[model samples]
Target: MPVELVALIGLLVVFATTTLLDVNMGAVAFVAAFVVGSLVAGVPVERVISDGFPAELFLTLVGVTYLFAIARDNGTITWLTSAGVRLVRGRLVLVPWVMFVVTGLLAMAGAPLVAVIAVLAPVALEFARRYDINPLLMGLMVVNGGAAGGLAPSSVLGSLSNAVVERNGLSIDPGLLFAGSAVFNVLLGAVGFVLFGGSRLAGVRTSAREPAVVRTSGPGATTAPAVAGSRLNGHRLATLAGLVVLAVGALAFEVNIGVLAMTVAVALSIASPAAGRRAVPQVAWPTVLLVCGTLTYVELLQSLGTLEYLGRGVAAVGVPIVAALIICGIGALGSAFASTIGMLGALIPLAVPLLGDSTLSATALITALAISSLVVDASPLSSTGALVVANSPESQRDRVFRQLLAWGFSLIVVAPVTTCLVFVLPGA
Candidate 1:
């Protein structure tokens, strides 16, 4: 078989197994890509391995994740969420939109997963209970919104993608990424909102009731009032103030996010050793591992001329509509196992080659990624879903998880399918 055909088959196998068997799709793709590249494509294994680990991207990702962890540990993000909820009066119908904006901003600020979620989750729950709106809906909203954040220019996802694409001799246009990401975010957010329903939001009210708060003694816990006051020294205040500046500078000035994030993480870590150490685990290693593993595989596959051959094979079929749907479906299912970045790594290697003659633009491919990510990252199998369940009241967590699972599938089905038919087909 031709290298392209082999590569396409390998992609299909990975996607199918990920969907059916619940395997780690990234690991599958990594193994498959290397085997095919060496045995069939005649690429050297050493070169493939060396090309896989894009160091600059990984460095920035780790640094930003670490810094975000620090913010989570310090309860900085929690305070932000409280402020956001207060500003909105905890309205059920408005919370999703508010969260979309807030999380987007924080993500742009290079806040880590736990930092953003910790700040937003508690407030969302309070609003859900108060308004009698389904907590599951609110949870999905938060997760989807975070996925949007990851796609933004300031996000680790965006930075990594930009770096990868650039290394492949593609341009890294931050403005284009920003614009494309905004479209993806809006469409996915709207789909999540619609599926969750506005009617479920009826008759919800908020009063002077203060929501229950979780006070852990670890990094994220609030300090005693007097202790907090006493510890508010100039150095500590300067570090906190620097974070605010970092957030604004990155978002408003369009700074190189990786550099900005590393600067913040390193500076803050040096400023307060105890706080930095406490925040490390909140960095979301699973996400990083997923991205790295998939990227490695994709790099190997690219070396084998798989994409070029696959493009010709796909063009031979000449049914753009059906092809688009199949790709989107594969992308979504793969994402369920590997998450968004991983899906992109696995699928794009085949997709780019297969759709070469078709009208599918990089933007359309990105749209598929955005929707797949929104669905799978919010699925019960994903970290976002796990966090939602873990953070919900113990009595309601199980029920909420199941509900969110259903709602998340609705997104997986609707958003990706719709984008395939509407966006990809029209472009093709």
Candidate 2:
């Protein structure tokens, strides 16, 4: 069999094993990457490690989680959660939208989507557990908001896509793309709100009542405050300062988030060794493993020509509209397990030839494709979704993972079709 075929089959096996058995998908992906990269694709082990391992992403996950873990350990998260609840007057339904808007603003301000999600998800999930809100609803809101914001002209996603289109000599409306993404995500968020019982939470008052006391029972127990009204102390103030610095440095200075976050975390640890010691182990290692491993396998697939082969085959179809749909589907599916920006880079250009020959609107088709590719960031395999699953209460992590997986896969079908109908068909 061809190396692409072998790599593709290896990917399926990894998914099946991870889903069916009690196994870490990252471990499975590492093995698959090695086998596919070395044995099937004739690449060396050093090349595989150098090329496939996502060191930047791994560091980002570790640094962000570590910083947040310290914040959680020192009560900053509780302070923020309480402040947020009070701001909304204990209206549970509004909390998700608050998170959504906050994340969106961060993304629009040029913060990386994964960084925003990592920083916010733990706090959001804590709020969900404290107030009996659905964790999935809260998590999805954060992811959606981040994604919506990521379409801004200054955002990483938006800038890259705009540059790609412009370089390819295709004209695109940045404002329309941003608006379309934001509106679509808002609509999806509204649907999620209703489906997850956002209405039932209306008028539900928790602020007037005594706040629940979160406690850690034993080893491996998740830590939370027994009461939400804890007054901010020196440690929390310092941690909050560190977080602000992180955000400013990342967004304004364009410093590497992973390196900057790690530096800040180390500083906080040195300042308060006890809290730092407690927070070290709280970093989301499994999530890091899962995300890096999945991406590694995806890198192997790309190196083996599987992704481009499939994309080209689909884009070669004579029917421009049908080819557009196929490209959207490929973007959605590829992006669920890989990088969204990477998918945009690979798939959008594949349609260049079709765009040159066909009557389809470049703006609409590219916008639809961009939306289709990114709308699935809620998938557990994606960085945002993984952070959500990782941050859930221990008892709820598996359930959240399953729910996110289902939601992510569903978007693979629904997003592309909807985008086609709304953007592509109207123009066609």
Candidate 3:
């Protein structure tokens, strides 16, 4: 049997084990990568660790979760939730849109997609619980918002995608990519709002509040909210400042989100070790493991030429329109599991041969590619999606995971077709 086929089978088996036996998908994937990389592919475990392991994402998951864990324990999150509600005047329906727009603007302004999602997801999920809004809807809005805004010309994705297009010698406007993604996600957000109970949010309102003061009496302990809408004490104030620093550093300076988060989290921990130690248990280790393992295995597939093998098939199609759809399909499917920026770099160039022929509209095809690739960032496996799952309240995590899994895979089918019909077919 082909090694690629075996690796593919191993992936399916990993998912099957997760669904059936309730095992951590990350552990199963790690074992699969080991078995396949070592025995079948003749690659060393050292190489997989160095080459396939998503060290950056690991830092991100641990840092963001740890930071937010502190925020949750200290009542800072609760305070922010109330502040957000007040900002929106307690009209529940507006809350998700606020999250969507804020993240969108941040992404459009050039924060990395992961950075935007990481900072906002925890706060957004709090709004979900506080207002009884659908957590899936709230989470996905943030994901989509970040993805949509990330397509702008100044953004990382836009820069990378345009560079690839220039290298591939395709004549396409960068603005079209941003416009297409923005429109698609806005429509998608509206659909999610409705489907995930957005209509119920109308006229719903809650009072604006301040952080209730809470204090620690001894080591490894904390008091509950002492007052509602009261002045935040020193610890919560310091934590909030750390969050501000995280947002500013990540967005304005383009610092590594994970590293910066770790720095802030560690600093806060040092300032108040006992209270900070309390947050260590709250880090989302399982989610960290799940995302990192999945990406490592995906990296193995990439190294083994599996994606290139599929890319070759895309170039061989006789019909331009059909080939265009296939490219979008592959982009969505691949981006769902891997990095969005990575997918843009990997998949868009595959259309070089077809686009080289000048038989397809570069605007429609490239826009379709961009939008299709990014719309799936809501998938549980993708960075934006995983960030959401990690930051979510414990009770909502499982439900968000299932919903995103279904939505992500479903988009693999739906987004490609929709983009093709809306963009490609019109031109064809």
Q: Could you tell me which 10 consecutive residues in candidate 3 have the lowest summed lDDT?
A: 211-220
Position 290, candidate 1: lDDT: 44
How many steric overlaps are in each model, in order?
Answer: 1, 3, 0
Task: List candidate 1 stretches off by more than 4 Å.
Answer: 11-34, 101-188, 194-240, 317-428
lDDT of 2 at 315: 53
Candidates by lDDT, descending order: 3, 2, 1
Give the C-alpha miss distance for residue 285 in model 2, angstroms. 2.3
Give Cα-based local distance difference scores for all models: 0.59, 0.84, 0.85
TM-scores of the models, in the order given: 0.57, 0.93, 0.95
lDDT of 3 by residue, 1-428 (tens): 87877777888898899899988888889988999999999999999889999998899999998898777767788888887777877787888899999999998887888888999998998787666778898998998888778889988888888888888878787888888889999999989888999898788777775545454343335667644554587878999999999999998888999999999999989997876777787788888888889889888987887766777887678888899989998889889998777777887777877777756788889899889998998998998899888877666677778889999999999999999999988877
Instruction: Give model 1's clash tally.
Output: 1
Q: List the residue pairs that clash in candidate 3.
A: none
